[model samples]
Target: MSDLAYSIVTRDLSLWYGEFQALRSVSFKARNGLITALIGPSGCGKTTLLRCFNRVNERYGNVTTTGEIRLLGKNIYDEDVSLIELRKSVGMVFQRPNPLPLTVYENIVFGLHIHSPARLNASALDEAVEQALTDVGLWMDLKDKQKSKATSLSLDQQQKLCIARLLPLKPEIILMDEPCSALDVEATRQVEELMLELAGRYTIIIVTHNMAQAKRVSHECAFMLMGELIEHSRTEDLFIRPLDKRTAEYIEGRFG
Candidate 1:
């Protein structure tokens, strides 16, 4: 049932936290193998929408959701859908680097240790660690530091390791919520470059308040306001020729 060209599609998706609505009938398609950015002012529900893809919002109390979310054409709301598998397919990275307090090798193979049906031997685990680190452009720097604690690395390296951990899960979609918000300019740039390198193989959706970062890294962008998606299009069109007044106003810094 997969839509070969699109990795995620949402139809009339709405969510409420107790009596407060967080997302209001958001509907859009994020193309396969591309980076899609969700941008809005703080508290505008960009992160809420991003969490929807993996159903992480359900962990918050008194939350309710309605409508449909499809991943590769399969409705994720279907009763048989597995939350564990859904999360594996849609990995997430947060605003700040949050590496596990374990060795780099342990961090990389942690998912496999927990999720793999068959117990993998040491060689398989080693290969997985190397590949994941290499994919995130960290193997050369950290290959000999396998026993080092992941949290001891620099902020940018820790962020890269956070991403590297996800790769071992073989995710199809990666979600980032203000991923570079905690890093300095050079660190942010390194993470951005890493994102660009990872794009073609996985569908990436990022929630960011930084419009310039959105312009720099995303292929497509969606603008939201007051829990509603205002506009979505190619990054250039959304920034240079926004069709919605709200989008234009936000882009122009008139109001957010």
Candidate 2:
């Protein structure tokens, strides 16, 4: 049996961007300790759907959503829910690497110092930063650069640093949105490798426009079309023998 439990579960989750509907009451289970990939065309709501996992879409103006999203067995939409706690457990990585403007060392411990229950003493903060960096395979690269500004690193290094920063928060789930879109093939592969390596340690969900990359990095894949979830299946089955025509078409290089 799969050791995975559902990290996130949604019931009749739908969203509207003003008058235009983006998500259509889509419900699915995001298994813990595995990478689930969302693949779809532009404007098809892949990113919107991914944003819902961490309530990132709440920042949008005039956007509204209906239904319940359960994270770790609790309804996150409940009135008494703690947004900070929910967010801490579900970290998100954006399309572009967004590290803090402060020192690299500061960026990693920023969240812990700001929100975690434990006090951010000097030794604790140092240990947190070191552990976070080590988890992302970035500790050696950043060991000497801890005093340097976070923006001083290259794009790939910056992205890795962002991951290092997020890891210190000890999130149970990570949502990545087209993290490799701005990268070259080689750099993209590095991030992909990192994602796979981090899967069992943390549940991961990725939204990507690249079908091949989805197949490469994801254990399970969900394809979206015109605001609808066309199909979700194991990567091997979805690519080799799709049940939906639209999914097959997109996978076969026809139209997304």
Best by lDDT: 1
Taken over the whole model, the C-alpha lDDT of each candidate is: 0.93, 0.87
lDDT of 2 by residue, 127-231 (tens): 988898888878888899899999988888888787777787788999999998878888788889999989998999999989889989999999988778889
Top TM-score model:
1
User: Which regions in candidate 2 have their CA more than 4 angstroms from the true location?
Assistant: 1-4, 116-119
lDDT of 1 by residue, 1-256 (tens): 1338999999999999999999999997999999999998888899999999999999978999998999988899999999999998899999888998999999999989889788799998999999999999999999999999999999999999999999999999999999999999998999999999999989999999889999999999999999999999999999999999889999999876
- Candidate 1 stretches with Cα past 4 Å from truth are 1-3
Clash count list over all predictions: 0, 0
The TM-score that candidate 1 achieves is: 0.97
TM-score of each: 0.97, 0.96
